[model samples]
Target chain A: MSRAGEGHRVTMREVAQRAGVSVTTVSHVVNHKTEARIGPEARERVRQAVEELGYRPNALAKTLVQGTSPFIGLVADSIASTPFAGQIVHGAQEEAWRHGHVLLVTNTEGNQEAEERAIAMMLQYNVRGILYSRWYHREVEVPPALGETDSVLVNCYGRVGAGPAAVVPDEVDGGRRAAEILLRRGHRRIAFINTTTASPARSGRLQGYRQALAGAGIPVDEDLILEARPDQEGGYGIADDLLATGATGVCCHNDRMAMGLYDTIKERGLSIPQDLSVVGFDNQEVIAGHLHPSLSTVALPHYEMGAAGVRVLLGLQEVPAGGILTVPCPPVERDSVDGAAAPPTG
Target chain B: MSRAGEGHRVTMREVAQRAGVSVTTVSHVVNHKTEARIGPEARERVRQAVEELGYRPNALAKTLVQGTSPFIGLVADSIASTPFAGQIVHGAQEEAWRHGHVLLVTNTEGNQEAEERAIAMMLQYNVRGILYSRWYHREVEVPPALGETDSVLVNCYGRVGAGPAAVVPDEVDGGRRAAEILLRRGHRRIAFINTTTASPARSGRLQGYRQALAGAGIPVDEDLILEARPDQEGGYGIADDLLATGATGVCCHNDRMAMGLYDTIKERGLSIPQDLSVVGFDNQEVIAGHLHPSLSTVALPHYEMGAAGVRVLLGLQEVPAGGILTVPCPPVERDSVDGAAAPPTG
Candidate 1:
C-alpha cells in the first residue's frame, strides 16, 4: 500500500491515544453520538486528534454493530445507455442521500447472470435494500436471489408475489392525457399512432385513448388507429397513411415517433398545429424540445417513480401486498397543439 | 429483519459444518483461491453446501482479510442530467465489473459540501479506488481529501500536482479531425463556428482549427471565424453572418449548432452538401442523426476516457506523474459534408 493508503487506514484507537481519552469517547465524537457525558475539553481534544490523524470510522464496522448498512443497491438494466430514463437513477440516488444512505449502483444490461451476480454482491454487503430498475418500462423476471433481500422494482414489474414493491409510470393515464390534450384543443377526430409490438405501454396507452374518445361520445374510428414500430422511422413510414385518414390531430406513442411525423409533415408542406396538431408521450427533452415547433407530450414521472421505489424499500412509505404502485404521468403542453381550425366549407 | 434477511445472514461456518469440511477449505472453495490441494469431491461438497444453505461471504469481512474492497467509487458532478456523457459512467462501471469490481456511484451536482461528504463516505468503506468525473470536460478543483485515496479524474483535470490520474477527451484533436474531414472533402473556404465562452473546449478546438488551416498552407481568414453560444439558437442567430461570408463549408462547435445551421441553410433555399458543406463536433445522436442530412461530426471519447480512468485508478494501466491523460476523439462521417462547390466563376 502507498503512504496515502496507509494514512487512510488510520485507526480510531490512534485518535483515542492522541486525545488522551478512552476509545468510547473517540467513537462518540466521530459518530456524532451522545457526547454530553464527555467534558467539552475532552470532546474538543478528540475532534482535534481525529482531524490531525485523518481517522475515518470504518463503515464495515459500523454496519456490523448496527445490523444495517447505510447503503442501498440499485441494480439498473442499463442506465448509461438509456437517454431519458437515467433520471430514475438520479432520483433514487438523491432520495437515498436524503436519508443518509449512499447508493451502490450496478448495471446488468439485461443479462440474467449479471443480475444474479449483482444481487448476490449487494447481499454480501448487507445493503439495506435494493432497487431493481429497467432501462424502459416493461415486465421483468425478478432474480430469485433478490427475494432474500429487502428490495423494490423501478420502471418494471414482475410476476405477482414474486418480487418486492415496484413503482412504474402510469402509461395508460399518459395515453389518456395525450388524447385529452388534443381533445381540449377541440379536435374530435384524433388519431393514435401505436407500436406494432405487444407491450404494456402500447396496450395501456391504447386503452386510455379508447376510454378518452368513448367518454367524449365520439365514435371510435378503427381506421384512424395505426400500428408501427415505436421509433422515428416507423412514424415516418406511416406518415402517408396517417395523413390519408383526414384526422386533424395525431397522438404518437413516443417523442421519437412524433419527431419523425414532424419531418414528414414539413416535407409535405403542412404546418404544425395549423394543418395538423401533434402530441407525443414521454417528454424527452432532447427530442421534444429541439423539434422545430417543440412537441407537446406526456411526462413519464420517472423521478417520482424512482424516489417512490427507494421510499418503499427503506420503509419510509408503505406499499400494498403484491407490491405494485403506479405514479401518474402528467401532460406537458408545448407548441405542438392548438385549437382545431373550423371545418372547411365547400 | 424478515425471514429472507435472516436466511441471507447464514454464515460460512454453517456451510463448512454442513459440508463436513474445515472452515479454511470452505473459504478456499468459495474464494476460488488455491483450491488445488482440495480434492474435487471436497470442492463439490462445499459448493453444494453453500447453495443449499444460501451462504454468502460478507464483503466487509472479505475486505478486511484481503486489505482491499472489490468496489470502486465514482463521484460525478451530475451523470443523469448529462445525456450522452452517461456513457462515461456506463463504461467505467462495465470495466470495473470486468475486473471483478463493482462501482459505487454518487452524484454531487456541483455542490462542494456534497462532494466532500461523498468522498468521505467512500473512504469510510475503503473503496479500492475512486473515479472523480464531471458532466463536461473542464478544469476542476481537486477536493483536498481525494489526495488521501487512490483516485482518477474522468473528463476533467485538476491543478498541477494537486490530484490523481485523469483521462479526458482530446478536444483539440477532435476539432482538428472535424476540420480535416471538411478539408479532405475539398473544402478550403471553411468557416469555424466557435463558442462565445472561454471554455477549454472552445479554445482548444479553435486552436486545432487554426493548426489544421495553417498546416494545409491556407491563409487563416479572420472573416471566416465566428463566435456563437454553441447551441441551436446561437447558430440560428448567426445565420446571416455565416452566409454573408460565402464560406463553402462550416465546422460547428457541436451538433446542436450544426442542426441550427442546417435549418438556416435550408430556409435560405439552399441544399445541403450542394450549396454548403457542414461539420459538427460531438456526434449527439438525437440532433446529428435526425437532421435531414445527418451531421458529420467528431465523436468525444467519453467511454474510452471513463474506462481508461478506471484502469489507471486500479493500476491496470500506467499514467504519467501529474496524472493527465488524453483519449483520442475520432471523426464520425455522415452525409452532412461533401465536396465544396467549385469556386464561383468570376
Candidate 2:
C-alpha cells in the first residue's frame, strides 16, 4: 500500500557504486552473507549510505534471475502450541541455512484445507521443496501438485503419486530402545502405554515393545500394554492402571504421556526409579528435565530428521519410494529407570 | 533446471476453457474456494481434466497482480532450539490461517545479519506483513527497511528507531499477578530470582516485582533478590543462595531456571510447598506438569500475542513509536505453591 518512489527512490546500483563494490557485494550484504568480509568502516559507510538514500533492495528481482532459491519450504502443523513441532522446524531451518538455503515456513492447523492452501502458496513462491510435518499421527493426503514437487514428510509417512519422500523417526526402533533400557535394568514386568489414536507410529512402537521382550527371553504380557490419550493427563490416568497390574517399569509413547505417569506415581505415594522406573520416547528438553526424578527417555533426534528432510528435497540423498527412512532412536538415561540387582545364578 | 514445456507442461488457461469456465473460475476451484457453486460432477470433471492435462497454475502471474498476499511472514531469532518459540509461531500461524492468511515463516538464529536477510526475502515474496519474534531476551537491532514495511515484533518491548509496533507479554503485570497470588496465600518473605543478562524483559520483570511488593505494603528486601544465568544449572546454583536467605516463596525468571531449582530441592531433601514454595514464569508444559508437586507458573499468552501481531501488521491497531503492546500473562495454579489456611489478619 505504501508505494516506493513517493519521494527520493534510492536503488541498489547506487549503493554499490558509492561503496566502491560490485552489485553482487551489495546484494550479499543485503542478504546478510557471513562469508563476505566487509571492514567495520565499509560496513558503516554502506549502512549510512543505504540509510541516507532510503534504498530497499528488490528481493524478487535478484532471486527470480537465479531461477531457483536454495530456500526450502517447511509447512508444519501447529508448532506454536506444541513444542516438539518447533524442534522439527528449528532442525530444518538450521540445516537449510548451513546448506545454503533459507526455510520458507507455514503452519497448517491440522486442517486438510489449510494444508492445501499452504502448499499452493509455497509453490507459488517457487520454493525448492517442502517439509510437511505433523505432531501426531494422521494421514497426509498430499495435494496433486505436490506430486510434481520435492517434499519430505516429517513424523508422518505419505505417498504423493509415487514421489515426494517422507523422512520419519523409526517408532518401532524407539520403542525397542525403551524396552532394552528396561530389560537392562533387569525388569521383566515392564508396561507399554500409548495414546489410543491409531497411527503407524503407535502400532510400530507396539511391535518393537513386543519384539524387545521376546529378544530378552521374556514372555510379553498383553495386559501390561495400556492404550491411553496422547497427553500428560492420558499418561496419568493410565499409570494407575499399570501399577494396579503390578508393573514395575513403564515405557511411554512420548514425553507428555511419561510426565502424566509421574503425576500418578506421586499421587499414589510411589517413587521413581525405586517403586516404578519410567522410560519415554522423544527427548523433548522441557519434558525430560523438568520432572522431579528427571525422565529417562528415547531421543528421536528431530534435528537430524529435519536436516535429512532438506537433504532429501535437494536430492542430496536418494530416498526410495515406499521405503520409509527411519532414523534410530537412542535412549537418554536420567534418574527415572532403576534396574533390579542381578539374581545369584550359575 | 527443469524447464517448463521441456517436460509435460500443463497451463491453467487450457484447463479453464476445457472446464467451460473462465480462468478466474478455474482458479477459485484450484484454490479450493467453492463459492462458485460448481456441481460435484463439475468439480470432479475439473480434477479429472487437471489430471489428464497435468495442469499446474501459474502462481507468479497471480501474485504480481495481487500486490499483497494472504501469506503473513513470521521471522524468529531461532526456532529449532527454543521451546516456547515454537508455541508462539504455532499461535500466530493458527490466528493467521483463521483469518484466511497463510503464514510464511523463517528463522534468523539471533544474527542481525541473518535477521535482515530473512526480512529481505520476505519482502520480495510480497507477504502481507512480517512477524519478528524472539524467545529469549536480547537487544534486537531491527533493519531500517522494516520501519517502512507492515511488521510487528514479538517478545520485544521497545524499538531503537522508527519501526513497526511490538507485542510482548506483560512481564511486569505477570510478575505483579504472581506476587498477588503469593500475597493471597499469606507469604511475606518472597524472593525474586532473575537473570543478570542485560535485557529489557529481565529488567522489566525486576521492576514489576518491586512494584508489586511495594503496592502490597510488603517491604522489599534487597538481600533476598538474586541474579543467575538463565538455565537449569543457573537455577540449581541459585536455589541454595535464595534458601539460605530465608525467603518463604521464590519466583524464578522463567520455567527453565525453575526446573534447576527442582533438582536442587531434591538434592537438599527438601519437600516442595512444605519446605519451600517455588513459582516459575512461562507455564512451560514440561516444567509446570512434570515436577513432583507440579510448579505453579505464569503462562504467557503467546497465541494472543501472535494474533495481535497480525492485527498490528494489518493496521488494526495504532501504537506510538518506541512503545510496546504488552500481551497479558495469567497465573496457572498447581501444587508447588502452598499457602496458609487463610490470609494473615493485619
Candidate 3:
C-alpha cells in the first residue's frame, strides 16, 4: 500500500513525458480547459499516465490563472455547541457543492478576534464568497472585515444596505402561526408562556400572538401572558400559574418548556388535548416526538436559511445589500393540541 | 462601502509605489520572508501601504512555491441530522486552526459516490491531510481516494493497515464502567437492557455486565438479560418483562431506553432510587440530564476522538499505520442510581 505525504511529489512534466505529449496538452486536460483541442489518442495516453502516476492538479496554481478560488468560506458563531443549528452548515455545504465549490469552515465560538481572523484567512485564500452565520436568529454586529468581502449572513440580520446580504427566520410569522394553531382549535382564552429574557424571538413571537388575538376579535388579556426561564424546570415552576389562568390552551416559547409543562399537567391528573392543550415553538424532533402525546410546535427554517444564504452569495438569488430575507417557519402539527374543551371561565 | 468581487484587483506594484519601495521589498514583507534584509522603517511603510490598499497576499502563488496547501479537509457523514456528533467537527476544526491551517469540510450523507467526489475535491485543493468520520462508531469501507492522501478515521474504523490511521471510543471499557457503577451501588440482581440489533456497543456492554457479575461472585442469569429496540418505545415495551425478573437495578443500553424505563417505573408507582435504580449509557445532556431524577450514564468521547484524529494526521502524535486508538468513556454520575433497596426475590 502506498503511504500519503511520504513519496516524492509527482509532476505534470513527468506525466507529459510518460504520455509522449506536450506539457500544454497535459495541462489543458488536467485543468478541464476544453477549448484546447487534442487528439483522442493523446488524451487517452495523458489520462493513463496521470492515473499511473497518481497526479493531483494543484488548485493553488489554477487559482492564480483563473482569478477565483474553488472554495467558499463559512464562519459560524457556535456550530458544535448548538445542535439545533447544525443544519445551517449542512445546507451551505450542499448548496456550495451544487455550484462546483467546496466550503472552508471556521467555528469562532463567538470570539470577535477569531471571527476577524477567519475572515482574513478567507480573504487570503481569495474565496469566491463568505457566509457569516450565528447559532440562532438575531441581530449581529457585522464583522468589520465583512466590508472587504462578498459575504452573506445566515440566521442573523445586519445593518440595512450593508455590504453583506442577510438571511433570517420569520420569527414574528412563526409566533403568529403558533397562536393561530391554538385559536383555530377553538381556544380564545389561550395563554402564552414566553422566555423571561429579552430577545428578538421573544418580542416577535409575542407580537404575532397579539396579532392573531386581535384578528379574532378577542381582546388581549395581558395577565394571561407569563414568562419563564425557558427550560423544563421553568415550565414546571410556572405550571400552577398557567393553570390558574383557566386557559384551555397554551403556547410555549420552546419545546423544552413544553415538556416541563407536560410533567406538571400529568402530575395534576390532566390529559393533553383533553383537560389542557399545548403548542410549542422550535419543533425539535427528539423532544417533541418522544413526548407521551408528542408535541405540536413551530419548526425553525434553519436548512432553508442556510441554503438561501449560499444562493444569495452565489448570485443564484437577488438580495439587496443590507436587506434581510425572511424564511418562513412552518408548523409541525403533532398530537399535543386539540379543539377547545369548554368556554373560558374568566 | 467597498463591495467584494466588484473592485479593481490591487497589485503588489501599487502597494510598493504607495510605500515608496521596490515591489520585491513589499513582497518580502507581505510574505514574511525573514531572510530578506529590510529596515524597520521600510517594513512599517510596506505594512501600512498593504493595509491601506487592502492588499491580500495571493495564497495560490505562495502555495505554488511552497509545495503545500494551508488547509485540511474533513468529510463527515450526516453531521446535521445527528446532533450528538457535532463535537467531532468542532474538535477537528479547533485542532486544525491551532496548527495554522483552516478546515475545508463536506457532508456526504453516507453516499458512496458523494464520499468519493468529496475526497476528489479535497485532493484538488491540495489539503495537507483529510479526516474521514461518521456519526456513529461502525466499520466503513475506506474510500479508494484515501490511498492518495494523508487521512485518519474518527468514530469509525476501516481495514487494518490500509494506510489510514483510526481513532475510536473504547466501547468495551465504557460498558465495563457502566456495569461497575451499578454493582458498586450494591445491586446483586442487575439486568442488562440492550439493543436487539447486533452492534459493537451492545456486545461490548453485555460483556462488561457479565464480567462485573462474575467478579462479584454472582451467577449470570440468562433471564435477567433482555434485548429491545434501543429506544423509548422499546424500553417502555420491555419494562414489564424487566421488572418480572426481580432485578434490583437496570443498566440500559442508552439514555433513550433509560428514559422509557423511567416512564414505565413511574407508571407502576415506583420511585427511581428507592424502588429501582437505573444506569444508562451515552450521557446525552438533553435526555440524561432532563429526566425527572436525572440519569447516570457513560459519555462517548467524541470530542477527544476528533481532536486526536487531527493530531495524528498533522504528525503531532505518533500512531502506527492501520492502528486504532481507543479513548475511554467516563461515567457521568447523576441522580438515578442509589444503594440497593432490597434482596432479589428470584
List, residue by residue over B1-346, the lDDT tens digit for candidate 2.
2323312335677887777767776777887886777778778777766766666665655554554556678887756666567767777877787677777677766677777777776766666778888886455666655654577888774446545578888778888877777777888888889887877668877888888899889889998889998777788888668877787788888888887887667566666787778888888755577666788888887777877888777777666556578777998988888873321111
Local accuracy of candidate 1 as per-residue lDDT tens digits, B1-346: 1223422567778889989999999989899887349998999999989887777778877777777788788888775666655778878977898998888888776788888888989888888878999877888887877767788889988877766778888888988899999999879998999998777799889889998998888988989999998777777777788887889898999888887776566666677778888898887756677677778999988778878988998788888766788888899998988898853210
TM-score of each candidate?
A: 0.92, 0.77, 0.94
Residue range with the least summed lDDT across 10 consecutive positions in model 3 chain B: B1-10
Scanning candidate 1 chain A in windows of ten residues, the lowest lDDT window is: A1-10
lDDT of each: 0.82, 0.74, 0.82
The reply for model 3, stretches above 4 Å from the true place, is A1-9, A32-38, A159-163, A320-322, A342-346, B1-9, B37-40, B160-163, B320-322, B343-346
Off by over 4 Å in 1: A1-7, A20-43, A320-322, A342-346, B1-8, B13-46, B342-346
DockQ of 3: 0.54
What DockQ results do all the predictions give, each relative to the true complex?
0.48, 0.28, 0.54
Ten-residue segment with the worst summed lDDT in candidate 2 chain A? A1-10
Which lDDT value does model 1 have at B124? 88
True contacts kept of each: 0.46, 0.40, 0.53
Q: Write the per-residue lDDT of candidate 2 for residues A1-346, one digit (tens) a residue.
A: 2334322335678888777777777777787876988777777677766766667765555565656655577877867656667777877887787787878777775777777877777676667777888765455675655654666777777654554568888878888889999999899988888778888778988999999999999998888888888777788778557866677788998888887777666666567777888898888766676566778889976777888888777778776657466677788999898975322111
The DockQ value obtained for model 2 is 0.28
Top-DockQ structure, candidate number:
3
Tens-place lDDT digits, model 3, residues B286-328: 6788887878999988778888988999889887444888889
